[model samples]
Target chain A: MDLLSDLFLAKAAFIGIVFAITLGIAAYSTYFERKIAAFMQDRIGPDRAGPFGILQPLADAVKMFMKEDFIPANSNKWLFIAGPCLSMLTALMTSAVVPFGDTVTIGGVTFDLQGIDVNIGILWVFGIVSLGVYGILIGGWASNNKYSLLGAIRAASQNISYELAMGLAIIAILLFTGSLSTKAIVEGQQNGHWNIFYQPLGFIIFLICAFAECNRTPFDLPECETELIGGYHTEYSSMKLGFYLFAEYINMFISGAVMATLYFGGYDYPGIDFVTAQFGNNIAVFVGMGALIGKALLFVFVFMWVRWTLPRFRYDQLMGLGWAGLIPLSMYNVVVTAFGILIGKPFTAGIVGVVLLILGLLIHDQLFVKKKIA
Target chain B: MVISNIWYFLSGLTLLSALMVVLAKNPIHSVLYLVFTFFCISGHYVLLNAQFLMAVNIIVYAGAIMVLFLFVIMMFDLKKNQPESKSSLTKLAGSVVAGTLLVLLIALLRKNNLPAPSEVNFKSQTGMVETLGKILYTEYLLPFELISILFFVAMVGAVMLGKREAGERNF
Candidate 1:
């Protein structure tokens, strides 16, 4: 009973910490993405508030809080409200399965650096992400605006298409790791060889799909302001709008973290166990966590950098990527990689599989994809 | 026990949305209400300790199937109020039939003895999903595959129904 109580309390505390960290990072990412964009454009961004605009996110929060909430006259009032709330909720909850660091032991107690450890952790993450589309669909439909509705339709199709490829690509990863738990995947990568080296093709597909799933540039048809005038959130204002924006940034952060954990070897530095042996477990766990955070932040930075670097793909091109390009590539990766795993040559056979995939793609593009398009 | 409050809240929301689905003025509103009803139903599925089903329900029903409904509704451009076609006598008769069926269902439910829910016996915390998948793919694999083929045929039929012959296309 005492141990159970302690676990309950610890879980509650962990939930609080995860919530605060995710919400805080999400709020700040908006500021950071903007500042990064500014730097790329050779202009100062949001420097008026506090030193180097460290406080700008706070100011923006205040502004968002104070803005007047509005609903269109024809809107379904309940659904209009529910849309952003659901979006924000699903985005925030997905981070619960991500293992941030190894366990830390203190005072004869050990704490896992994750919100919840489920056997189906990867599935939980993917499942939660698939729900994020509801935000777009509901927001668009509830807005009762043509542009918003169109944006929602585009988003739903885009997300569903990319998600198939994404799931297939991850299945390829799972074939190698032979486990679906995020933590286990990280452990599998701890031998100084990340899955990205083994299954670079799958990693690239996953990375592309992750970007699309988050509705980032080149796949952000849901909120293409240039064309759709703010898309699904056009009818929203005040905190409702804040929720939409917050959910996007948080989704970006979660996807970035997932990518790092899945493909970039997570918090495993080259000789992390050696370091822990030299020092203590707690200190090593803390350092590993820092390394993980650093890696996650690097992916986050890349997300923003790509946003600035790449132009949005046309809707047709985006669909083509999802359907024609990604789906087949991912499926082939799955079949070959699964066979490799079964044959007891995951690393070596993965290389051959990757080579075959490249050759197949080259032949397909030259003969099939191009011919079909023409 | 405290977390149960959230579950209760979601359940209430789901029930309310279902009620609204029946009460809505327009077909479009009905469809929107139906989507919300799915959302709430998924919440209940979550509460029932089936996380996989919760996600699958949302994906298959709310995300994919409901979008098809929305698309069709949008294309049709339905009015706020459907035109009443049946007479008062017919409507009265229909109501009587519905009410009688409801009473019969209630009576049947009240009279029938239900088995008590089995105590939690599964070793895995994710009991429902694991068990369901085990039963579905193994013991019921042939039937499941058959049903899937049936669904494929139905989908093809739907496409055929939607398409016009080349000779009629110009017209």
Candidate 2:
């Protein structure tokens, strides 16, 4: 009973820490995005609030809270309220399965630095991310606005289309790791055995799909500001709109963490084992945690960089890429990976898969594009 | 004891949401209720330790299917077009058909003497992803492949139905 209670307490603490960090990172991501965007354009970003605009998120939060909470008269009241709440809920839920660090042992008690070490951690993240679509769908539809409805439909279709490619890409990695548990996947990446080394093509596909899944730029057709005039959240005001926006940042952060955990060496660094042997478990755990966060932050930075660099994709192009390009390429990667696993040459298979993917693209352009032009 | 309580709660919620799915007047509301029903059912799956099934249920049903339902519902301006009231005779016939089906289901269930209830083991690994994968690949491979073929055929059928020639209108 004592051990069980201790475990419960440890889990609760981990949950609290993860939740708080997720919110904090999400809040600061908005500020970071602006700074990154500004830097990309060669301009100084927010410098008003606190040092280097460090307090911008707080100011933004206060403003959001103070703004009038408006609901359009024609909207479905219950669903209108449920939308952002559901969005925030699902966005935060993915953190539960994400292992932040290696296990820490203190005074004979060991605890995982995650909310819950569920066996099907990756699937849980996928499931929760899939459900995130509902928040947008419900919000857009319930608003009773044409723009919102269109955005909602686009979001639903976009998510469904991209998820197939994403799942296939993940399957390639799963073939290498042979486990769905996030911690197990991270552990497998220890000693420089990261999945990216084995599944480079899969990683590229996964990264692109991750962008689409998060509704980030180039694929953010669902909420293209100029086209939809604020899109699904047009009818939302105050903290409700804040929730929708905040949810996006949280989704970005979680996906960054997931990308780090899956393809990158999550929390795994050179001499990590040596450090654990030398300095004790707690120090090693802290270093691992720092490395994991650093990787996720780098991914987050790349997400913003790409957002600023690329323009939103045309809707047809988005759908075509998802279905025609990524899906087939990911499928090819999966087949190549399967063959590799069978032949005891996984790395060779991955390299060949990448080459094949490029060749397939060139062949497709020649066969299809040449015909269309003629 | 705690597990049973959770089971009862989830079952109750599932039944309630299923009822609401039918009772809701608005099509959008009905779809939302249906999603709630899927969520409750997924909760039941979780309680039973079928975590993989629970995630799949939520992803496929509550996430994907319900969104499609909502998309279609939102496409039509259902707010202005109220449902027509059914005639008493039609209602009577519907009730009779439904009642007969319910009675037949109950009778069939009563006729079969189910095996005695087994002890509920909380630590069962039957539903784990690894175990399920092994069983599926070894024992259920044929059926699984057949199901994929079925889905492929359905996809082709849907595309055929959706496609229209230039300047063609079926209606």
Candidate 3:
């Protein structure tokens, strides 16, 4: 009974730890994004709140809380409430499947640093991400605004298009690792050789799709405020608006963590197990958790970096990237990877995949790329 | 049994939404209510562990189909108006027919003494999409092919219905 209670306590603590970290990181990422953008543009951003704007997110939270919560007169009150709730719920739920670290044995008990290490973790993550469309769509439709409706349509189509590439990219990784669990995927990359080396094309495709799916620029067409006037969240105010904004940041962080877990070495640095052998499993797990978090944060920084570096994509350009660029690249990536696996020549397979990708691109350009020479 | 509880809840939602689709005085409200009915039916699909079907149902029916409905409703410039009142005799007769149908259904249920369906182990090892594809392509292939033909015929019928005749005139 004591053992069971201890086990439960550890599990609860693990969840609590992640919840606090993710929520905190998500809140701060908003501030960090602004700061990064400011630095890029050579202007100070949000430094008035505290030392270098560290407390800016806190101040923003206070403002959001104190603001008057208003519901539109014409809206269906029930579904309007359900919209943001569902959005936030689905966004946070994806983290449950992400494995943050290996097992840490403390005192005599070992606990995994994941909420639930289910076998179908990858599918669960994808499924939950797909559900996020409802939040944007329902929120926009409930607003009864033309811009919001257009934004929702853009978001839905964007998700559908990019999801195909994302799924295809994931198939390459699955083919190589032959595992769907995030933990297993990470472990599969343990031998100082990440799947990224074997499947560079898949990695690039997944990264681009990740950017689009999370609605970061240059793919943030849904909320292109200059064009669509706040897109899905135009009608939302106070906590509803907060939920939409917070969900975006949380999703960014979660997807970053997923990328780190799936493609990067995922805490299997040069000599992780060597240290584990000398010191112990607990210390190793602690270090591994820190390393994984570091990697995830690095990816998060990259997300913000890319956002500031790139201009917002035009609507047509965005769709063209998904269909014309990413889709065929992903398909060819899959076919080549499958052949490589069958033939047991990963190096040759990677080269062949790259060649096929370039060939596909050349064909696309020849066929669809309008002749500017004319 | 848990699923039965969910079924009860979702069925109530579907029925209520369907009723609202007809009873709503505003045409836009009726269209919105119809979307809600589609969502509830999608919930029923999810409860059945038909995850792929559930997503497709929502994406196709609620998202795409209802967006078209909303577009038409918006384009039509429907004014909000109260429903036309029915005469007491007409209301009474409608209720009588509905009540008779309810009674007939209850009588049939009682007379048939339908045995409780033995619970089958329906949990699938494969993903919902894979299982659905396997079934549709293998065991249900003929029916699936027939359905495609039926869909094609329906498409032709719709075009015929929607097409304007050259000789038609406004009186």
Candidate 4:
């Protein structure tokens, strides 16, 4: 009972730490995204608030909070309020399953550097992310605006569409690790045996689906300003609009963490054994965690990079890419992964994936060429 | 004792939310209540230590299906077209049908005289993913495969119906 209680206390504390980390990273992501965009576009970014605008997010937060909490007269007040609350809640919940670092022992009491350890960690993330649709859907419907409704519908469809391919893509990881737990997946990838090398095709499909699921460009038609003015959050003002935007950033952060954990040998730095042998487990654990965070941040940079570089896909093109392209590719990956496991040659899976990818590119090229001729 | 208390609370919330689903005036409110009901049931599944079932239940019902329900309901102009109220006779007929279902359920339960799920001895691992997956793919492989094929067919049918023609927008 005492041990259990102590464990509970540790868990509660870790939850607080994880929440702080997720929110802090999400806050800084906004700053970094702008800085990255500015560099890409050859312009100076937000350098006003503090050194290189480190305090810009804080300023933005204050501005968001100080602004008038406006609601349209015709809007469904209750659901309008529920929308952002649900959005933020679901985005935050996905962080609970991520194993941040190895355990730390003090006074012979071990503390896990995770929010919660569950056997179904990845599935829990999946389920929570699927629920994220309700936030935008509710907010859009409640707004009583055409653009909001249209955006919400598009977002719901987009999320659901991409989820199919995403689940199938992750099947390759599950095949490789043979476990649904994120910790187990990470453990399987220890000493640089990452799933990415084996499941490159799966990773690419997952990356695209992740982009779509997060509603980031080139899949961000739901919120593209050129088409729909503010889209789903059109009628939202102040913190509510901030919640929608912040939720996107949070989703991006969480997805990046998930991708890192899934494919980038999470919490496993190169020469980890040497580090642990030299500096001790505590220092090594910190280094491992730092590496993991650095990796997640790298993926976040990729998200922003893609957002700035790629143009938004037309609605049909986006749907066509998801249903016609990624879904089939993912299913093929699943089949080849099954065969690779059966044959006891993991490299066979990578080879098959590459072969299939080449064939797909050729087919798409041929189709494009024929369309041009016609 | 605390566990039982949580189970009771969760089951109570599940029932309340399920009732609210039928009673809510707004279609969207009804859908949301249904989602809450699914969530509370997921809580019950967690209480029973069926983590996989809880996740799948929430994912399939509260997440995917309910979102589609919300999507369709959101598109409807609710203020313009109110549902027509049934007459007294129609209400009586509906109540009669519901009453018959209740009576049949009671009779079936009394006939079986089976113990409640809580009273039955069950293993902690019964609802685990490994056990479930093994049983699904091994013992129930054919049925599982058939059901998946059925779903695939449905998906294909949806795509066929929704497929865009030349010079036409699908959406």
Candidate 5:
């Protein structure tokens, strides 16, 4: 009983720490996104609030809190309230399985830094992420507006279509790891044996799907303000609107963490073993934690960078890309990976992935670009 | 004792949500209630040491299917074009069919004698993915492949239904 209680307390403390970190990263993500966008476009970003807009997110929060908590008169009141709450809930729930560090030995007892490292961690992520569409759907439908409903429909269909490719992409990774646990998957990638080297094709597909799932720019069709005028949250106000926006940042952060774990190596930086042997597990743990967080933040930067670089996809183009391009390519990736694994030549998939990508770009340039120019 | 208490609470929630799914007047509300029922059933699966099943159930049913249900239901302005009220004869026929189902369920329950929790035993690994995978690949390979083929056919059939005819009129 004493040991169980000790474990419980340790788990609770770790969860609280992780919770704070997730929110802190998400809050700063908003600031970083604006700053990056401004930098990309050669304009000054928000610099009024506390030194290069360091306090901008806090100011935004205060403003959101102080604003009127308004619901549309014709809206379904209960569902209107539930939508953003559900969005925020699902966004935060995924952090439970994300392994922040390998493991920490405290007081001679080992504890995982993650909230829960269940054997089915990846499945849990996929399941919860799939449920995220419901929040947008409910919000859009409850608003009782044409634009809002259209936004919701777009979100729903987009998520469903992309999820198939996303799941297929992960199958290649699974072939290598043969385990569903996030910790196990990350552990397998240690010592510079990152899955990215072996499963390059799968990584590309997963990255695209992750972008779609997060609804960042390019795939931000659900909230295309110019088109849908605030999209699913058009009828929402104050903190409700804040919830929707904040949820996106949170989703972005989680996606970054997930990508870092799956492709880049969670906490397995180069010389991780050397550090552990020299500095001990406790000190090494912090180094690894920093590495993972750095990788995740880097991903967030790339997400924002791409947002500034690319234009949003047309609805039809988005559908066509998911169904016609990514799906078929991911299926090819799976077949190539299966053979690669069977033949004991792990780099076979990587070589094929590079060649396929180049061929695709040439085809696109030759066929599509020439047609447009002519 | 604690497990039993949790079981009771989850089962109660499941039944209540299942009831709400049928009783809710609003179609969107009904779908939400059905989603809640799925959540409760997933909770039951977790309690039974079937984490894999619980995750898949939520992903497939509550996550994907229910969202599609909501998407379709949202398009209709149900209040403005209230479902043309059913006649008494139609209502009577619905009851007759539903009543027979209820009666059959009760009769089936009465005849079955399930082993008590203490009497039956199961390995903790029984429901885990690794063991389940081994059993599936070794013993249930043919049945599993056949089921997947059935699903593929059904998927093709759905596409057929959805494909627009060239001469079809558009609103």
Candidate 6:
């Protein structure tokens, strides 16, 4: 009874903390995005709100809430309401399985920073994130508009196509780590060598897929303003629109954390062992948590950087990249990784895999581009 | 006690949703209900301590398959063109076939003489990913490889079927 109560209390606290951090960071990401974009383009951004627009997200929230909530007359009312709700729900759900930090020993009891330490943590994230596509699909279908329908269809096809490559890429990392649990994977990387060193090709493929999954540029064709206006959420107004937009930022934050956890070694920093030896366990845990958050934030910044740096892909180009480029490349990565493990030279195998990937890309470019030119 | 209660609730919800999937007037509503049914079934898998199965079920069935179903339904615009009801003779034949299958299933169950329910070993790691992987590679290796071959054949068949004819305009 006592243990159960303690578990409940710890879980509740962790849930509250994670929920707050996810929402808070997601909200502020908007401000950071604008600021980053402005800086990249040589302009000051959102300086009107409190002190360099620190309160811009809050102001935006207030504005969203105050705006009139409109539903198109021909739209399916219930599904319209359910669309953004489902998006927000699935976006938030992915955070539950992600380990924010290693266990912290508070007094006599040790508590995990993750909300729930499900054994199949990575699979759980994938499953929940896959469901996030429904939010766009249903929202667009409910809107009773041709543009919205097109956007939703495009989003669905793009997500499903990229997910195949993403899953294949993850298989290579899984072979190296030999475990599906996020905690186990993170712990395996505690010896100063992150998975990125072993699975560089997989990381690149996974990063591209993550961008597509989050519906960010250059894969943000679903909502390309020049074409589809507002895409799936074209008919949404007020907080409904806010929910769809917020869900994207939240997805970005979760994917960033996932990438950090998978490739960059979650919460594992250089001299972490030294810090643990000098300070206590609790302090070390906090330091690790900070490191993880910093890694995640860097990934988020990269996400924004890419968003600003690249233009959107045309629809056919996006599909071709996913199916022809990534799928085959990821498959080759898995095969090379497996062969390497068999030969007992995993590092050499990874390097060979990367070399083969580059060679293949050049060959593909020469073959396909030359044909098109001719 | 808590586990049993949760199981009962999940099973009940699953049955209700399954029924709704068939009974719903709108095709979209039916797809959504099917998704709900999948979720409830995943909950049952979790209750059985098959966490990997639960995740796969959700990812494959609820996430991918249902999304495809929804996409197809959206494309058809069924609301604008509701099909006529089935003929009475066809409905009668379907019911008869379904009834016969149900009776045969019940008869087979009775003949099996199943043992009384055993207490679940919640702590057992039988359904863990590692255990499943070992079984798949060792005992079930041939069957697993065969399934992959089957999937490959199916995929090739689909691509063949879907290919555009020469000189045909896509539109």
TM-score of chain A of 2: 0.96
lDDT by residue for model 3 (B1-171), tens: 366887898899999999999888777678768877887987887676666666567656664566556555544434444356899999999999999999999999999999875568446544466667788999999999999999999978987996668998733
Instruction: Give the alpha carbon lDDT tens digit for every residue of A1-374 in model 5.
Output: 35468788888898898778889999999898888889988999999999887999999999999999998899999999999999999999998898989678888888878888788999999999999998899999889888998898999899999999999988888888999999999999989999889888788899899899988878989987788998888898999999999999999888889999999889888988789899999889889888988998998998998899998899989999999999988998888888888888878657876697789889988887746434
Q: Which portions of model 6 show Cα errors greater than 4 Å?
A: A1-4, A360-374, B86-113, B117-123
Single-chain TM-score of chain A, each candidate: 0.93, 0.96, 0.94, 0.96, 0.95, 0.96
Model 3: residues >4 Å from true position, as ranges?
Answer: A1-12, A72-81, A107-110, A265-267, A359-374, B1-171
User: Backbone clash tally for model 6?
Assistant: 0
Q: 1 or 5, which is superior by lDDT?
A: 5
Could you tell which candidate, 4 or 5, scores higher by lDDT? 4
Model 1 Cα lDDT, one tens digit per residue, A194-299: 8887787788899999899888987788887789898878889998998888888888888888998898888887778788899978888889877877787788
Docking class of 1: acceptable
Q: What is the lDDT for A99 in model 2?
A: 86
Off by over 4 Å in 4: A1-4, A363-368, A371-374, B103-112, B116-121, B164-171
Candidate 1 regions exceeding 4 Å error are A1-4, A66-68, A106-109, A177-180, A364-374, B2-17, B26-50, B70-91, B106-112, B117-137, B148-171
lDDT of 2 by residue, B36-134 (tens): 898888888887788889888988887778877887888998957788989999999999999999999999889997776577754588888889999
True contacts kept of 2: 0.75
- What local lDDT does model 2 show for residue A12? 84
DockQ of each candidate relative to the true complex:
0.26, 0.58, 0.11, 0.61, 0.62, 0.64
Candidate 2 DockQ vs. native:
0.58
* Per-residue accuracy of model 4 over A1-374 as CA lDDT, tens digit each: 34368898898888998788889999999999999999999999999999879999999999999999999999999999999999999999999888889998877889998887888988998999899999999999999999999999999999999999999998888998888999999999999888888888889999999999899989998886777888999999999999999999999988999999999988998999999999999889989888888888888999999989988899999989998899998998988888888889887778876887799889988887656444
By TM-score, the better pick of 1 and 4 is 4
Question: How much lDDT does candidate 2 score?
Answer: 0.89
Clashing pairs in 4: none
Q: How many Å off is the CA of A208 in candidate 2?
A: 0.6
Question: Which candidate number would show the highest lDDT if scored against the true structure?
Answer: 6
Which stretches of model 2 miss by more than 4 angstroms?
Answer: A1-4, A363-374, B96-113, B120-123, B163-171
Give lDDT: candidate 2, residue A173. 80
The alpha-carbon deviation from the true structure for residue A260 of candidate 2, after best TM-score superposition, in angstroms, is 0.7
- Each prediction's fraction of true contacts recovered: 0.16, 0.75, 0.00, 0.72, 0.75, 0.81
